[model samples]
Target: MSQPVVVVENLVKVYQKNIRAVDNISFYVYPGEIFGLIGPNGAGKTTTLRIIATVLQPTQGRVLVYGYDVAKDAAKVRRIISYLPEDAGAYKYLTGLEFLELVAKLYTKDPKKIEEFIEIGIKLSGLGDRLNDKVKTYSKGMLRRLLVAKTLMVKPKVAILDEPTSGLDVVNAVHVRESIKRFAKDVGGTVILSSHNMLEVEYLCDRVAIIHKGRILVVGKPRELMERFEASNLEEVFVKLVWGA
Candidate 1:
C-alpha cells in the first residue's frame, strides 16, 4: 500500500470548561485521494480539520502531514497544506482577478509562476469575465467558487477544506464538487474535507469517516458502509449509526 499523505492517531481536542469537541479519533488519507469527515454541525468535524490544518492544537494525540507533525513542525505543515474554513471569506474589496493575483504573489515571487498560478486559479474557478468583478459584487455561489479556486490553485500537497460546497445552489454545488474532483484527479492532490451533505460526500470522497458527538463511528468507502449498515446510501447509514434507527 502507498504511504498515507495525512495521518491522525487517537486525536482529541478539548475546549474551555472541558468541552470535548473531538474525541479520540484516528484516520488516514492517501495521496491522490479525497477523504471526508461527515457529520452534523458541532459533531467535531471542523475541530478535527482545524487540528490537522494547524489552526488549532489538539489536546491529545497527533496529526501528521507528510511525516511532519502539525504541532511540532507547524511551519513545514503550513508549507504543504492549504486550509479553507467553513465560513471562509474573501477580500470583498478586491476584484476576483486581483485576489488571485495577490495570493499567487504570496506563494511565489517569479512573475511567470505567478501568472501560471493565476491561470490555474481561473481555470479551477470557471469564472471567466466575472473574474474582473469585485468579490463584493459576486453572488454567494460565485464567491464560493472563487474561494475554492484560491484554495486549490497554489497546488498544495494537501488541501483541507471545511464544507467546500455548503450553501450553494445545485448548479453551483456541482461546479464546486467537479472542481474538487478535477484537482485531485489531475494534480494527484490529497484532500481532506468535511461536509454534512451525504450525497456530496458520496460523490467526492475516496473514503469517509462518519463523525458524531466528537468521535468517529465508522470509516470506510461509501459502498462498504452502505452494505455494512444494510442501507441504501450514506445518509441512511449515518442515520442508523448516529440515531440508531
Candidate 2:
C-alpha cells in the first residue's frame, strides 16, 4: 500500500488548562481517501482538525502530513493543505471571482498559475455568470459552494474541512458532497472532513472515525462498521455506540 497521507499519533488538546478538547486520539488517512470524522456538536472534531491544519498546537503527541510534522514544519504543512473552517466566510464586498483570485494570488505569484487556479475555481463553483456578483448577495448554499470551490481549486495535497455541508437544503448539500468526492478522485488528494450528518458521511467517506467526548469511539469503513455493529447504516451504528440504543 502507499504511504499514508496523514497520520495522527496520540493527539491531545487542552483548553483553559483543565478541559481536554481532544484526548490521545490517533488515526491515519490515505491518499485520495475521503475520510470523515463524525460526531455531535462539541465532540472535539473541530479541535482535532484545527490541530492538524496547524491552526492550533497540540498539547501532546503529533500529526504528520506526508511525513512533515505539523508542529515543527507548519509552513510546509500549510503549503500542502487547505482548510475550511466550520463557519468560513468570504469577504462580503468582494465578488466571487475576486475572492477566488485573491486566494489564488496568495498561493502562487505566477500569472499563469493564478489564472489556471481561478479558472478551476470557476468551473468547480458551477456559478457561471454569478461568479461576477458580490458574495454578500449569495444564499447560504451558494456561499458554501463558492467556499468549497475555492478550497479545492489550488489542488492542495490535503484538504481539511470542518462541516463542509453544515446548513443547506438537500439539493445544495448533495451538490457540495458530490463536488468534494469528485475533487478527491480527480486530483488524487486526501480529504478529511468532520460532519454531524451520518447519511452524508456514509455516502461520501471511504472510511470514518466516530468521535465523542474528545475521543475516537471507532474507525473503519462505514459498511464494515455497520456490519460489525449489526446495524443497517451509519446512523444506527452511531446511535448504538453513543447512546447504547
Task: Report the Cα lDDT for candidate 2.
Answer: 0.94
Q: Lowest-scoring 10 consecutive residues by lDDT in candidate 2?
A: 236-245
TM-score of 1: 0.98
Q: Model 2, range 137-237, lDDT digits (tens) per residue?
A: 99999999999999999999999999999988998898899889889888988999999899999999999999999999999999999999999999999
**What overall lDDT goes with each candidate model?**
0.93, 0.94
Whole-model lDDT, model 1: 0.93
* Model 2 vs. true fold: TM: 0.98
lDDT tens digits by residue: candidate 1, 30-56:
999899999888899999999999999
| Collision count of model 2 | 0
Candidate 2's error at 160, in angstroms? Answer: 0.7
